[model samples]
Target: MRPTITGLGPLLDQIGADTGMTISTLGVLAAVPLVAWALFSPLAHDLSRRFGQPRVLLWSLVVLLAGTVVRSLPGPVVSLWIGTAVIGIGIAIINVLMPSVVKRDFAGHVPAVTALYTALLAGFGAISSGVVVPISHVELGGDPAGWRIALLVTGGILLPFAIAVWWWAHRGRRAHSRSASQHGRTGIWTDPLAWLVAAYMGLQASMFYMLVTWLAAISMSTGRSEVVAGVDVMVYQLFSLAGSLLLPLVLRGRIERFAPALIPSLAIVGAAGLMLAPGAILVWTPLLGLSSGATLGMSLTLMAQRARDHDAASALSGMSQSVGYVIAAMGPVVFGWLHSLTGGWTASLSLLLAVLVLLTVVGVFAGRDRYVLDSR
Candidate 1:
């Protein structure tokens, strides 16, 4: 999921060259999966209830692998869009279930576990972003479509291994034993606090995806090479890993209320830096990455903490991510459209700043330690 989100940044130009598509059109490619995420996220809890989490997750992995293969195949442009949507659907299921797993398995250690999960997400995303371009440069099989191979490697390579491990971990487990009655009803959709969480999730997700999809283009627009721009994204993701790893420490004290707002404030500085000093990308990219990583961890932690149990966590997770990603899916398209409309990145980046401001404001309220569906 991270690879699909972040790895494609550097390769967008090459893909555009191969497909004869404009950058703005390709921005829709980035959003396709996000749209799938929004559409499919809400179904995860129901799926889990029917087949159990492990089985559903295993099936999602298979779907993800298939999507990766389909999208990477060399042929009709429609395959790319189709495969991207499939990948989005697969990830959307996993995204909603992951928080529930943390809530169930690690009950008391939500923040710590979420931090580790998000840190690894950023770490793998960094590797994918950094290496996909260089991998495309490798003359494997004398393939002219090196970008396809790069996408395959980054997106599908580990899926088989993951599937094997998952199956082995829960081989004979009774997946179909769980019933709807075991998980109580949840009114997450109508809850104002849930909406706050969803808003924060959506806003942060928009900012993250916007950067994932366009930061390389933004860097290249400033006269950097594709490889250099890729490196910038890699560095940004590495710092995001750092931020994720550091979040547990930051949240250890009584600063929970302010941490949400405080962390995203860094993104304001980063977005401003991109606009004001495009030359100093290295300086600002880390700030953006850190903010993104920490805020993501915070958001996931909130999903877990704000629920009474794993069932509620899954429900809230599904709801928040479903609504959140609808908002997120718009980010890249809007950013690209803005750039195409204005003929520069200034307006596009200003949009990001405006998003960051909204993110900060929402984070303040969402960060309050309150459980969803709690009558208190």
Candidate 2:
């Protein structure tokens, strides 16, 4: 899932060269999957209810695998766009279902489990971002277009193994047994707390996705070589991993109350640093990375922690991610458009900083300990 977004950063130049698409167009391409995420996320809970989480998740993996192949195929540009949307659909379902799974199976250990998975997510994303360029430079089959193979290897290779592992793990598990009667009578969409969570999710996700899509390009624009820029992205992801690992440890007792707001404040600092002092990327990158990872972990945790049950968790996850990715899908395109229009990154970085401020405000309210749809 991470590779589909982060891994594509390093390959964008090559893709542009091959497709003759401008940065803004490529930004739209980058955002296609996010749009899919927004569109498909809402259906995941219902899909899981009908087919069960395990089955729906397994099918999603298959869809992801298929999308990976299609996206990597050497063909018309439309294939690339279609495949990306397919990949987004798969990931959207998986993203929404994961919280419910954790809520159901790791009810008492939500933070720890969310941390573990999010850490792995960041770690793999870092690996993909770091390695894709080098792999694309490799002369496989004497083909000059190594980016296709790089995309395939980075995004497609482990999917089958994951599918097998998932199947084996839940071979006989039944679908979620909860019925409509088990859910809150009021819709999760109407709950103020759920809206707060969704706002936090959208804001944080917009920041993360925007950076992953353009951070390497932003680094390269500063006169760094492509390889060095890729390294910068890797560093960002590693720091994100560190942040993910550290969040659960720090969220104990009283600290938990302020963590949501505090973490986004750190991100605001990072974005400001990037805008004001672009030369010190190494310093700012880690700040952004840490904040990105921790905020992501916190958002996922909120989905589970604030839910009354796994059902509510699914509903909350669906709503938050659905609304969240819609906002996120705009970030890269708008950022790229700003850069294209202004001929500089000042406006683009300002856009990011402004969003971070809004995120911080939403996080303050989202941090409260409350369940979705609760009358209290």
Candidate 3:
């Protein structure tokens, strides 16, 4: 999802008659997944229950691949929008189910699993952004259609992972059945803790997407070259991966209460860096990445810890992701619109700082080691 969407960095200039649109406009297009994620969030569990997770996941990958492949085909702006929407739908399904899978399969290790998953995902994002231009320029026969080839590579890359997931599912059928039967009575949607989990997920996602869609542009406006700006974005994500990996290890035993306060503090620094010393963003970007990535993993970890059983975990994951995505989907569009109206990124940066403040306030409550039920 990150690669497919964030890869727009190089293409933004190429969009629409080789005429460049503002970063805000590009942000709107890049953020389409937010809408799809919100819409698909509620259905993740239903789809899993109806077809089984393995089948649902398998198909989601296929859909994801198809969406990217079709978008790569040369066409007009409308076709690009259609392709983007399709990719969003595919990614939304995958994102919702991936957490539930970890919750079920690695019952005792949500933090570790989420950390690793996010780290690798962030790494993939880094690679995608770095190579987007190269792939478009050198690979795929060097045609404008080359962009399609570059985009399609991600879908192809996912095939092996999808196949492995299929194999893993075949072997885990017995465990899946047992877990399903056990969680049959309690519904996750009715739980208050579930709402907290979802809200955290949405808010974190909103910040991440907002940055992903605009960070490069922000750098460019600050006088960085497109290459440097892209590299800066890649560095941000690499640090995000590192943060995701390190935080779970660092916070493992220290999170006795409100460990989530760390997220907001980090966000504050990031906001300040973006607005105050745009040149020093390279330093601040990693701090933001670390804080945000760690928070995301922690949020996922909380879902499993809070839920009483696998069913509750799945339900919570779905609810949180669904509602969270809806809230998140608006971040890019709103950020873009705000920027367009203000004529500079300062207002947008300020808006993001406000978001970070909210994150900190919520993190104080959400980060407590006590389970969601205890808070209630």
Candidate 4:
């Protein structure tokens, strides 16, 4: 998730200042990984089949290291773009393969392992977003490139994790084998239920991302100071962590059709709270955070649970994330455009409400106890 951290608010502005990149250019920089995820995600299944999941994971870490170095090295604008794209590509591979890895290694311990996985990703992101400003204040070699140093420090912290993954890959080289015959005839894309899963993933993610983009502004609208509004965002993240940690217990074995619907109801409740109470973000932020975290956990868990095996897990992960994320990436942009056009938050909130309804409808189908391989 260093890739996600690298694109945080403080880091984005610092990178733009260091490289003379405009806001529009910075938006593209931020979007690079999502686009790369959409493009490269499906390939992870093929790559894993050929080289093994562990090996592919190891190499993706290597790409992350290289891209992290190149990206935050106080380079030219072009290098920044290239490095960001490289980092995005690396994360995309890991993104698609990790849930599959959980399916293979912790088949019996799915909930616990999935919670740990999701928590760590979100945790790192929160730390990065909060620390980048402070990190920017620190001088590295007297370079004053605090943003650059901040990213490098984050990447360096990942070195131990990379080494561990590499060790795992080298040890497991011959334990893996590929068999195309194992895959069922149904591609993930053709399944109606799979689309519901994808829609659930995308809509929830889009709502989360869209809220993250404007949460502070929304807070400030109610007369909160910038500092307080920022704290509100952090509070949302903390409760989100709580949500992920707890939701898995609720979804340990088979899922009910209403499990997914439960998550969006949190969002809908929070939205209603905001509209009804106004300026009382303190009251509803936690519910919204829990909804975001729990919803994401459900989506990731479904990627593994719905699959018949690691191959199917990878395929489902690839299809859902690749397509789902591309859809999610448009959310903030759409909201911003709506805000600009309507000159208020009503239109955007209305859109958010509409998505919540759609997600609820889709989650009813996605949350059913059906397997992806059975779709055909």
Provide the lowest-lDDT 10-residue window in model 1: 177-186
Ten-residue stretch with the least lDDT total in model 4: 2-11
Clashing pairs in 1: none
What's the CA RMSD of model 4 in angstroms?
Answer: 3.1
Q: RMSD, each candidate, Å?
A: 1.4, 1.3, 2.9, 3.1
Q: How well is each residue in 57-134 modelled by candidate 4, as lDDT tens digits? A: 888888877777786665466666677788878888998888988999999977778887877766666565555556
- Model 4, position 176: C-alpha lDDT score: 55
Every candidate's lDDT: 0.90, 0.89, 0.73, 0.73
| Models ranked on TM-score | 2, 1, 3, 4
lDDT tens string, model 2, 83-145? 888999999999999998999999999999999989999999999999999888887578654
Candidate 1, residue 251: lDDT: 88
TM for every model, in the order presented, reads: 0.97, 0.97, 0.89, 0.86
Q: lDDT at 42 for candidate 2?
A: 91
Residue 160 in model 3: shift from native, Å?
5.4
Model 1, 1-376: lDDT tens digits are: 6886678878999999989999789889999988999999999998998899999999999999999999988879898888889999999999999999999999989989999999999999999999999889987567543888899999888889999999999888778635444333357788899999899899999999999889998999889998889999999999999999999888867897788899988889999999999989999999999999999998899899888888889989999999999999999999999999999999999999999999999988988888888775
Tell me the TM-score of model 2.
0.97
Candidate 3 displacement at residue 102 in angstroms: 1.5
Clashing pairs in 2: none
Q: What is the lDDT of residue 354 in candidate 2?
A: 92
